[model samples]
Target chain A: MKFTRRDFTAGLAVGITAPYVIGSARAQGATIKLGMCAPVTGPAAESGGYAVKGARIALEAVNKAGGILGKQAELIVEDDQTTNPGIVLAFSKLAAESDIVAFLGSIRSTQVHAMAPDVLKLGKPVMIGGTDPNLTHMGNQWLFRFRPNDSYSGRVIADYGFNTLGKKKWAVLHSTDAFGTAGGKALGAALEKLGSPAILDQGYANQSQDFTPVVLAIKQSGADILGSYFTYENDIGIFARQLRQLGVNIPWVGSPSITNITALKLAGPALYGTFGVADYAEESSEASKAFGKAYRDVVKVAPDNQSSWPYDAINVLAAAINKAGSTEPAKIREAILATRKFPGAEGEYNFDQNGDGLHGYNIVKNEKGTIVFDKHIEFTD
Target chain B: MNNPQFLLPNAVMDLVLQLLFTGIGIGAVYALVALGFVLIFRATNVVNFAQGEFSMVAAYLMVVFAVDLGWPYWLSFLLSLAGMALLGAIFNLGVYYPLRHRSFLPVIIATIGASILLANSVLAIYGPQPQVLEGWFETPGIQLGPVYLDSQYLLIIAVTIVMVAFNYWFFEHTMLGKKLQATSQDKEMASLLGISVSTMIMITFIYSAVLGGLAGILVAPVLFVSIQMGSTIALKAFAATIIGGFGDVAGAIIGGLALGIIETFGAAYISVPYKDGFAFLVLVLFLVFRPQGIFGERVAEKA
Candidate 1:
């Protein structure tokens, strides 16, 4: 058809607008999308919120310094609802998006376990804070950890309980789930290496309101020290309260749950003098201090391991994406594995081939319900 | 393959008894919650999934009235109970009444939705963190020979007994009780007789909600008040109700106590890891073998 002056004007406008819209969409395509699966509503919500906050802070910092591959990064968050089934569904929804270059896993080993098969299927790198050592060795190529596994923490706890405290007899308490059982076994093996096995080894379930019987058993076992791997903050709080009420005043060394603010706040003075190997402590390092201050400014609360690790994971992932020069999964994986001497809020991390990093733990003490950073313990294995 | 030694030494026995007492103290709290579940289910066909959250909201309200608003413990407790009763009535009017004629699934889902909204609203206002209830009547343990029982345990048991007796009298002796029974049995007949079935249901909801609120206030010192605390206890109370016999008041009490003892003894003697599973195991077994529950009457086939 012949074009009039008005038709020609409209055609020019359409041509110009179409190219801008197409260019904008293509430009947006350069930005990498990352999915974060965290427990935002259940018992672990406190920690999960922190993790999200940490990730956001890291992402903002990365974007300010010129985002990954010169494009802005976006985080797509899904609440895991603090269950294995919920986590699996969340991961599947994230994986279906196709644009996500990497994934940020939850702090709970069970959540990671539920999401791992999907991660392997998707072939995208996942930075996780779950401490279960077997998560990495489970032959999942895309699974990478940002914190020292429970095996390392177990060794640290065992050594500190046995050698540092000079307590030979031990009572080991853990949850019956996979993470607890694995951590308990690792701790038992570590203690055995020192020629001092746990006198009374016990496993309990989560969300228990009373832990008196378990504490009494430990008290009766004649163990002068207590080693535990509690999977939930509430259970740990109850256990700590009952342990004190039963007059079992032995030195207690535990996993990261002992340092969680929820446990500390719930247990109150009951958790005083308790020790744990934590991934993050506000006083751990300069990076942690700065992060803690920033977090406190935003959330009006101190940062915990759950918050710090995800924060660091995002930073490390962003750094890798920038270095990779593309949002492609394989390239991002390469950049992540190449992470070396990266200072993060959690600690200096180096992602190994198996996707584990931060091969160290911070020895912390709960002083009158506040986590006091004591010292750092590094492991080579 | 021999039986493992279960008894502890004398010193350990003393410690174990103390721990058992502690469990019982908390068990009393569970019993109170389970009792609310039983009362409502017995009076109405509704399986109020919001019972635990009702308790939580009441407990938090007590904190607000007592601690923040600076009311005395007793006054705060009474005011919170009244507030809970009002909430119960409102919930019935707003939620259950609209969906009363619907299938059980919709009502159940509606309760779940209400629970989510209630919990999140609390979280949004109070923030998602645990808050300690101040001015608790945490009396020191009373020593009776070798066993030391906390005064809180005694208070819980005494309060539960009084509440149970009051509920029994209200359902058995009063005119309102007869109307409630009539409404529970056949709503059409009750309404035909001008007993006001809708009004009776509202009263039942209020009574149950008040009981749940009382339970929450009493147990707050033991379990602490957190937005997410309701779901766990609610599940346990559901299991307790099922095992005791759904819609049976006495069965609920028996079931709650039995669960408490079983869980306590199992944790002490058997496996602590499987302690919480004890209730579920019993619930499943009962569901398979005795679907009508321990105290429930067998129903005839519908015409």
Candidate 2:
């Protein structure tokens, strides 16, 4: 109780650092938190499950190998409901947490677009799987794309169909949404470059119950080849069946949805012998194969872009955080932007200044319900 | 080569025929779901916003019994309908009966709330993944000359035909059906006549639920069963009901077919992106010109 010199100094020191000590203690309560907006119960819910699993698996490995900044990494997920508004709301809920260092956004381009304004407001680096070319190019510095944008997919689809299939006249079909429209334009541009401008370019709304008009037009167009960019698995499934039914069976190559598990299951034999420019072909790369084996061992399903991109996103994000040696957003963003020659389940991550990680796609063939990886097509530019 | 200027060429004829068949096929699905809407509106004097959820719930039930439990398809079909009947009863007691005396707005809002609850409950239980239901036919479709017929669509068309015939017979010939119609037309009058108005309303709910369930089951194979399936189809069905005449059964069928055909032809000739636009455009035209609907009796506005 006596006010001595040593006691006075000790009391003053304790008073100065008390709040800091309490803050540090509270922070140590759990691992580094990363938020994810996934379709927990909407049209894309099935893929949402895969996305969650992929991020967890990758994060688990990261945690085992020495957690992010020596703290175990934890994932926080909110249901996006496979809708634009749903994703925006879910992301806002997660963003309000304030403790989450970084986030993973939707795979659907439209959903990503929906949450982009809020993401910019939060000023945090968000890894997204949406392949719309405009996603990264729309001057949203905070939005980093884990998957190659649809431009690569469009080019790959057009290249494979025109060169490999040896077909000249083309019928291009696409969904009218952002992803499909960009993809169709890219495909059309590529085909024009290859001297095979599509004789027919048609756009249909998503979730169309029927595709007879589209199919009949394709048949009437007299195109020897078909190229497509579909937004949903079920839409593509319905279209595929109707196409075969209407006898419009020409050499066909489509974007990634054509090779996804849902499309394969729904379309069945109708999709046989078709080509798709998949970003995550299981046999495309050693990393892809490894991820495929790991995913199947755990999820008991074939690996596709839905799961693979998030898997890569976690791996890259964790590594970037490690390299930056901090949980600060600016440091992590720099490390991510500087990521080079980082092998991922999708492909090699060579992020550009604009935040694109991959620059090409893998072409796969659906042969009798089996997806056989054909070849990888990467562009230097 | 010498076909009339107005008449279609052979190639054009084939396209028209295919589109027409597809239009009719999709129209039948809309008609089937629209029937539930019309029936419920007739009984309750309030739109059952959850009519679509009824279809979704029944389809999920079918999936549980038929696919998950691996029961025989026919047995699953029957059990699913039975489940829907029970749900209809619960819905009447919980949703409609409680608000029987309330204005139509609150009841409509309550039905909307029920729809959200039903969809979320299923999502919580089933975890949001779309399920695939195999069609009744092993053969996907049959190619007859230039036109191909999907077996599922064919079955839907056949079922719609049977349902229309059955509805005509039931409403015209059966005492129960007449009692139900009387109750819908005038609940107090029917009760005064000792028709048991509440019982007729209960029966109407059950019948509409069953009808919605039937449409869901029939379309599941084509659309692939998902949580949003009910709402998507219901939107078009709502439009069909409007076009058909709000209270008229036959009007729903004609409206559905007409919408389907118009949309198909519009997409084929005009713009595929505006496919849904065509359906609603026709709806707008009808609303502007014929708000009472095609088959609905001329209703004088209350002065």
Candidate 3:
């Protein structure tokens, strides 16, 4: 307990190593590193890559606009491997880097949930595409959502499917993952609000290759309409095919994954008439149209929610950085919380204290393998 | 529930039958993959976890050769199978042979490593997006009474039968078959009797890889070709292999078909959400009660 020169030298050695341990964190450099955690190589790679592309486009655009705080903004990307542990590791690696001021989180709610604690501990802002409502409301100040949470999308999907389409007797199908379960629960609640309960509520695992039984169950349940929140595009594609094969011609409304180009292409004619709520559509708004056209010029495909949110996320983040005039976390966080009337590929954006921006969902229909935007629904609270 | 009257003029019945047909088609693909798993496991006692990746690689190769290079489907198909066989041989020589005498766990793990490497390599080369294979074989579904079946499904069933028959004949009557069987039964004894155990292992891998390639090529028309396709089918086939008795050839074939039927029926009658779970649940039950599998031979522990 006594102070001595030996102890003082040892304490100084610990202090020096502590700063070294936090690699890239507070590095004496001008470059502002924005960490991007995405699924670059797994089942969700198609969508995740698009998100990364959008983020990169935003990064390039921001750097062109004189960079953030007059310092070059660099995106430090890490593949999340599409698993919880992988995401945690990627986040930790990024968090350890002192120069990384903010991060772009994954589309998987589970991954975001796993990465949230680390993001909070690191005290860095993370813009996320995951729509799980609890992600922002879980007392995590650093977590920012670029897309409207499922709680908003679910009500929109139910309202559109029942009131707009004037169909009742719903069949709700969802993947049994965190996103799907929560989306399904939200949709079911929305349906109940309209005095119509789901005749058949089902949950399938991600990456399922067959959806015959699910389709058959829907057919037998006497449901005239269907709603789903599939976790994987492939599963949604297969399910769409099986549903058509089973002659279930009812109006189908689903969550964002259903509107993915991959699903549309794989399912082909089977998904032609399906409707869903998405964060990004090729034809959402004038701003969205420009973003979509630009994305098509680069990626040679129409933009979906996966591609659009990250585009908006980057633009919003860049705007925040520019407005704050600093790469410091508190300044950027304040600017992000003050986001208002900023046009994005998704829609006009505003960020709450919880970091969720753009409180609207784009209703889209699969019009012969193309996502045709129908309408947009904005929400409060 | 068994009343025939319940079946007539009911859209629900039609839906069930349609699902059954669809499940059968998908299940046929699973059976084909499972057959490959059995072939390699039986001859080499090495569970090729990368069997699915073999199929994926072959399918992608076919896409590259046939679709991209504008070769005929038949030509590309044959070349893809040959390419997979060659890959199998290379894998056996490079990875399996060196680790042949090692524990089964190491061999399994190695296959997993190989699977990851192959999938990632394909991703790196082809990029992550799914590609549709172009060919004349991709015709629209043919109506069959109340239900419809894609021509690709029929082609898959026919090809699977032909391959299964060919494998049966080769294993039962061929000299190479006898040598392989001899090696599988007793590798050291077969080596003493002048049969090359390594060669037999290589041949077995080639055979299985070809089967996997054929599955990929055939199923690609329905599912389209993607790197992740192999892993999904591989898991189902693994379950199928366990159900049929790990090393039982007939069990693998029958077990695959039975699995397809069970999954289809279970999905229709039980629950659609947990359709894949049915196979895994059955696998766990089988492991608990009949670890050797439905048709697997019982082996004594060496220790």
- DockQ scores of all models, one per candidate: 0.45, 0.44, 0.33
lDDT of 2 by residue, A6-45 (tens): 9989999999999899678657756788999998887888
lDDT string for model 1 (A1-381, tens) is 888999999999999899899668756696668899988777777677878988898888888998877778889999898899989999899889777778998788888888888888888888888888999998997887888998889888988877778999988898888789889999999999999988888888877877767766775677888899999877776677656655678899999988888888778888899999998887888898998988888778878887788888888888887788877888888888888988888888877788787787888998877788888888876
Q: Which lDDT values do the candidates have, in the order given?
A: 0.81, 0.89, 0.82
Please state the CAPRI-style docking class of candidate 2. acceptable
Residue A24 shift from truth in candidate 2, angstroms? 8.6
TM-score of chain B of 3: 0.92
Clashing pairs in 2: B244-B251
- Chain B TM-score for all candidates, comma-separated: 0.91, 0.95, 0.92
Top-scoring candidate (TM-score): 2
Per-residue alpha-carbon lDDT of candidate 3 for residues A1-381, written as tens digits (9 for 90 to 100): 899999999999989998676655445575778899998877778888888888887788889988887877889999898889989988888888776788999888988988888888888889898888899989999888888888898899998988899998888888888899889999999899889888878888787766656765676677899998988777777778767765789998889888888887777898888898988876667988888888888888777778887888888888888899887889889999999988888888887777788677889888777778899888786
Tell me the tens digit of each residue's lDDT in model 1 across B148-174.
Answer: 665666677778788779878988999
Q: Comparing candidate 1 with candidate 2, which one achieves the higher lDDT?
A: 2
* TM-score (C-alpha) between model 3 and the true structure: 0.90
For residues B127-149, could you state the per-residue lDDT of candidate 2 as single tens digits? 77778888888898898898899
Say which prediction, candidate 1 or candidate 3, comes out ahead on lDDT: 3
Angstrom error of the Cα, residue A124, model 2: value is 1.8
Worst 10 residues of 2 chain A by lDDT: A22-31
Question: Lowest summed lDDT over 10 consecutive residues: which window, candidate 3 chain A?
Answer: A21-30
